[model samples]
Target: MFKNILLLLCMTALSTPAFAQDHAAQNADIAPDMPAKFTVNTDKFDFIRRDVMIPMRDGAKLHTVILIPKSAHNAPILLTRTPYNATLMTSKAESGTMRSVLQGYDNMPDVIADGGYIRVVQDVRGKYGSEGQYVMNRPLRGALNHTKVDHSTDTWDTIEWLVHNLPQSNEKVGIIGVSYDGYTSLTALINPHPALKVSVPMNPMVDGWMGDDWFHNGAFREEMLSYIYNQDATAKKTAIWWGNQYDNYDLFLNSISAGALGKERGMEQIGFFRQLLAHPAYDSWWQQQAMDHVLADLPLKVPTLLVHSLWDQEDNYGAIALYYALKQKQADQPNLWLAMGPWNHGGEIKEASTLGPIKLPSDTGLYFRKKILEPFLAHYLKDDAVALPQRVSAYRSGSDDWETREALPARDCTTDCTTLHLTAKYQLAMNGSAETSGSVSYLSDPAHPVPYVQRPVITRGAANSAWDNWLSTDQRNAASRPDVATFTSPVLTQPVSLDGQPLVHLTATTSGTDGDFVVKLIDVYPDEVPEQRELGGYQLMVSSDILRGRYRKSFEHPEAIPANQAQLYQFRLPIMNHTFLPGHRIMVQVQSSWFPLYDRNPQTYVSSIFTAPPEAYKPATITIDTAKSWLTVHTADVATP
Candidate 1:
């Protein structure tokens, strides 16, 4: 991995290459290189920290932390629906976690309360601090989003109770949250609660089954998600610092594997375990409460704001797909607005932003985006603050700048939605054909997984942890390694925008009975000096996946890999809303296992998604018909010069 990183540092993403840039100087700022800084006020909004039991429809009491302005006798309602403990308020947290940003500003109380408004934060049913047995990924059974009740029905009931019961005015409420909170906010729109108005699901993951958190193409994100619930589900009513490794730094930092904590704490909630073992295929269980299923009843709910990060690494793809769908449904209803930023699923620290351990200006600086969010609420519940213009704005990668459009990305979605056919190793480069032959392959060990930072789930408590599986080195870099396979294209003379789902189509026979087929779409720019810190320049990972070789043909059933058989292997990875700009090359990286990040697929197709030991794993030969096998991507024609 360091060797891969070393090569990356030398090549650089933006410039004077081969002669080499100073690696020591270049590597330091790789994380906070893109300098966008702001300020913050770390003082906590001393709202009446009252622990009230918000009665669910099932008559079960769920805990809520109401952080109303101490000064406000009458204020508007700013609600956050969370699955993590509602009591998990930060003593040092000022801006809000990435999850808080998704759910809506945690600073609503301070932002508007100074302006005079109340922030009502509620924990969802069956999770931390809330009463009832927790069901991981519970479908919205009834109107509420719960097993017996559901979020839609439960939320409506809560709003009804809070408005009448809690001390507030205007009877107006706005829902917000990220990940689970985003789901909860979406539920607020579905079947429309009359009192609920205005909402923002930041980097929200709408579909539990298909593209978000739990699984993608039947591949479960075993470590990040499970590790988190274990620590959190078993924790006491105290706020721990998120965004780093495990709960105990000494243990994780000392090179302890993730399993040690679960065993030490004896924290077997089994919520996640049941989720992993239960569904091997995309079943009705996952489909039941997906946003797509309930979109017909989606309410406009006062003005809704959709904030997603292009590099969100977690929920953006799923959320963006759902956002476009919702925009189409509510085309006539001028209530939806989309904002995409450069931050990860939660918030990636800015280069110059002030932040420290104890939390002061740094803590406050974290919430600046939350401050930007203040105006949205001020207008709706309080009927004040100037309104924002243009419903859509997205930050573009490579260019490292923000772009805004009046309408959705019609130019890309409509015009650039051309399908590229996948045959073997070489992909038709827009108007051209492949230069290289053979398939792109790599070794994906399930144990020593890579790292997924700068995206969401940089910490455990983040709402989306799906992409954590790709936490390792680049597949192209990995392909450069003997254990992997590489398929490269000559750097494009014309810029291409890979704006949608990138597909890998192949007809190959695998050796050693059965194995998985993994595909990664990568953007390789002209090597330059590592600007901020990513050495060897940065080759941003567009999307990736590992299709269980056994389930290569079907997700529902499993089959064996006949030795050296010419069976078809097709992998449709997560979507990529990216622009592979000019002077950059597009490469495909293929590898088998993503290590401990994702559970290992015992080269032989198996009934279980996990528990495949290392002995069961063996190097299998996957034939990529270079001349016949090809990869396809939804790319934009280079804008005619």
Candidate 2:
């Protein structure tokens, strides 16, 4: 029951903000008065919600809720597998909790009203109402030959039972969901059933360590600790606030270290939390847990629509990684496609037109639902002949235009892809003077780490929380911090466009053996914006990444940084398509820590950071050697519109 609440947390916050702008002319086809909520009144619709336990191949029964239209003969079945309990959709037992859970619950309510399909929502095995032992990202067992049971097998079994058992069902099944639910949809693609025609996995949690939900570049996400505690079967839901503390930045810091905080809250008893501490490095433990490794060899048989978001706070890289992997492996499977827009985690279901104070060109949420998602699924499920768009569909953040391609564009040449050297004077420039070889040093105190954003950092799982849009906030607060090294370039004379991943090559020396490097690529708006007056001098973070110093060589083999020695640390930031308009400046902010968001690295490298005592946390000085360090960016010349 608790799992259902956590699963729908972000989905609820995704729709809190209304589309405040008037884009009727821009989105002419989309209804101007489209309800702010992403749900339909169940009472107004003629459907019967039946709860039943579906038996799996392994004899494990799964709890499922079948919502069938009264006029359902010859209609197809639209199914969604979820860890979240399914009865919340139809039960009027607790109106208060039901209202809270379904605040922004998103589903094909329009399709339900149209009454052409029977909607099936079920709980995944071992979660909530389902019976079995729960395992996160249950590793795929290579192949299915009546050997072992995984999510894929469970999906196949469920679909097989539904097609044969349900009356008036045409035996056609389609799967769809978001976040954890999306993961289940993805699992259905591997060794799928014949009846599983289509699936859509939006911002799915594909991997634990590789920039999706849990860890980033092998660095543990401290902000998600509360979530880990919340999901523990034995533990109750965690309080949103940490004992009257307004700013999570301060609350997390006061706890000393992440492990210390977990211990204080008795989180170390949780199996998943304990496992995280056991395998700090990307060893076999994390390797098996990765979706890439699990589904690496399995060919995608079912046509899938991979959905991701531009500002997704959680699981940003998974769908993109999946899209790329599918492109190479399923080259002949032309049905594989990607659609990305300007939204946070699960924000695509909401008003995608605006993120925080920024406004997109149109209501991308409506456009995506009407033009892409609805049609793509309808074509396969209902045999509708409406054609889909190009394979790759992405929204350019600043440009405010959708760019579609048969395949992702390649990196530009040397002329267009420029390399800028970081200067000792805190300047980012194209030309470097060998004679002016210098380094800038700063004091990095674990006690007073750099805050990720100016606002008080809130836990992301809370409803209508500010955590979703923190990525879009200005970096003025962090740039002015003494621990952060700021490098600014001259105002751009011409518009510069970036179309690929931004690479950061750093040569730095740390006083201690273990630390972190957070590199941020920012777009500095002009000081005077006559039209949008408040947006003047806005420091919009375009791309950013973090790497643990110990993981410099390999994630599998973490070698501590040689103290006081300049070591080269190379890593790529998340890929993004954005433009630096004329009169704007490009800035880079490098820091040793991003507090609360990431665990504070105890400068001294120890055998186990989790067991390291509070004394291990100490102050250290980090130097950025400009002579040997540079930031390279992949850019494209202005193309004709």
Query: Which candidate number maximizes TM-score?
Result: 2
Tens-digit lDDT track of model 1 for 1-641: 99999889766754554325566567766787554866443254344445688887778888887655556665677777776556654233445332232233333324544555566777776666777655544566654343567677778888898889765467888887766677778777766678877887777777755667665566655445444555355434343333234422232323232333333434344455445456657666566656756664555655777766544555645566676677677665578777665455544222213111111223322333443466666667776666664566554444433455665543233344544333244454443343434454334343333322322223444445334323223444454455545555666776566554556666666666776566677776567534433434355566676676766666666667787778777766654556666666777655665544444555655456444434555556566665445556555333332
Best by lDDT: 2
Task: Report the lDDT of model 2 for residue 623.
Answer: 96
Q: Whole-model Cα lDDT per candidate?
A: 0.56, 0.77
Q: What is candidate 2's lDDT per residue for 553-615, written digit by digit as tens?
A: 998888878889999889877767787888899898999898788888889998776667788
Can you give the lDDT of residue 27 in candidate 2? 82
TM-score per candidate:
0.72, 0.86
